[model samples]
Target: MVEHQRRPGWAEVEDFLSATLVQGGTEMAAVIESIDAAGMPRIEVAPTAGKLLMLLVRIQGARRVLEIGTLAGFSTIWLARGMPDGGHVTTCEYLPEHAAVARRNLDVAGVGSMVDIRVGAALDTLPTLLGGEPYDFVFIDADKSNNVNYLKWALKLTRPGSVIVMDNVIWEGTILDPDADPDAGAIRAALEFMGASPLLDATAIQTAGSKGWDGFAIAVVRQGSATLGE
Candidate 1:
């Protein structure tokens, strides 16, 4: 079953935090600078989303985490911070410059050892990762055009009960309309896949704020061999 909830914009909260907490943190400031230097879009997760991901990781006792996008390592820092003592996160970023910035940010965060930033197209990198092991949490935030493909690959690499969280699922409300463009269509297809998959119990929550009109789709893999949509 699929469920959803809409909340006040998250940007306001993020703005407030940016002004108060993150404003004077040298390391965080440096990370932001690195992101800016990379020229890649530095779209970090909303504060609430970051906290929620951390909580989910801890709750699931996740030892292995997979992230499809590492845009200057903001989300990577959050994920790494949530891991258990020996837990690790493997994140993929296609842009070399962006990956370098992310590496620097992660290093400054003091969680560098806990994160592995792989530089390559996620489509090519994900398959190679499959042979290594299963992940307890998979965060997808890469190219929207390949969301469906990513979901398929994620499903195969995650064990039952693993959580898969897709960022930008709403695509600024474009997916809500019948006249969605190509990117929105790709997101819609991913949503349909999640809604129809019997192997997952999923929900979509709409959020607003500094991040604009976007949202996340979270799917928890069900136990046993049941298919999705069953």
Candidate 2:
């Protein structure tokens, strides 16, 4: 395993960007507070990243969003807020306790009604959504080991032109050496799957922030693409 380096300025700039453009406001703050209160891992996306998710949802004109993680409902709030009046977000969380905290946070954020919190492994929960309307956007931010599995599910649950975003792809540059860790190996496999899949056009970007050096991959289902695992 390689040591990850962080410059003091990265987080400073992130805070500045959050205050200037992200402006998450009180609801986001309360979500963060709730996570702390529940002793949950503070692994929610950065404010800028959360805002980006919101913008992506809006830009995609997504009425239905599927999220593989619901940590304190921080990102879930952003995803829900981006949708139109009747938009819905379905999020899966493995831990019941984490889901409980997220439930309170989502309700407090005033977007609880727009969100469906599925408490279980995402692989199991995702299967239940198979026959529903296809999601317009999908966000995968859960356990790294199942990234490709989540991507496979995303392909199954989304239509052509639907967008999918996977977080923590860079993983402090550990992806350059998949043998570094189990998570790194899985991330590498997921990226490889995305790159080689004929049904998608995808790209990834590296980012530096309070979360250290990490990044995300974004992909769009190809027009006339055949749905996988049909």
Candidate 3:
């Protein structure tokens, strides 16, 4: 296990900044506690990242959103909370138990009504999600092996001004090493895909906090590139 020494530098700064800027309500706190009680994997975005998602949604005036992962609904609640009234969030979860816990957690947070939980492998469920109104924002936090494909679906289901966010791409900087793990290779491949794709203007930001070192790839859709429109 990684040692939990008190980080006196950037990570500590992040924790302080998060506490100063992002305030979680009682319901939101319960959501986190419930996730722990249920013994779910602790892979959800950090509080700062969750706040960032909310801020991005509010900045973009996004009325509809798609999330590729729904682990205990932490990020899902954040996204839903950031939207205006009548806004909706669609989240995909492959594991039934995780989805069930997420559903309960979302309800406890009072954002369940704003979310549509799609239970299935995202690669399969994504294709069935066609013909709906395109999302104004898409967050890809699912399996990294299919990161490129997720971007393709995000593009297909978004229009100009839409934003795409991919999580955990940096993997503590392992992606830079040629002999890294498969997920690291996949992250590099996704970066290459973003570089070559004409439909998106993409960039990434490194992040650190309680979740350790990682980063997200963010993209904005190009005009007239979406094959389908809302």
Off by over 4 Å in 1: 1-10, 17-26, 226-230
- Error of model 3, residue 20, in angstroms: 1.1
Model 2 local distance difference test score? 0.95
* Candidate 2: stretches off by over 4 Å: 1-8
State in Å the error of residue 107, model 3.
1.1
Whole-structure CA lDDT of model 1: 0.83
- Order the candidates by lDDT, highest first: 2, 3, 1
lDDT of 3 by residue, 32-133 (tens): 787789897788888889999999999999999999999899899999988999999999999999999999988888888999999999988988878788
Give the higher-lDDT candidate: 1 or 3.
3
| lDDT by residue for model 2 (1-230), tens | 98888755989999999999999989999988888888888999999999999999999999999999987889999999999999999999999999999998888889999999999989888999998999999999999999999999999999999999999999999998999799999999999999999989999999998999999999999999888985
Poorest 10 consecutive residues of model 3 by lDDT? Answer: 221-230
Instruction: State the displacement of the C-alpha of residue 43, model 2, in Å, after optimal TM-score superposition.
Output: 0.6
Best of the candidates, TM-score: 2
Q: lDDT of model 2 at residue 89?
A: 97
lDDT score, candidate 3, position 139 = 98
Model 2: per-residue Cα lDDT at residue 49? 98
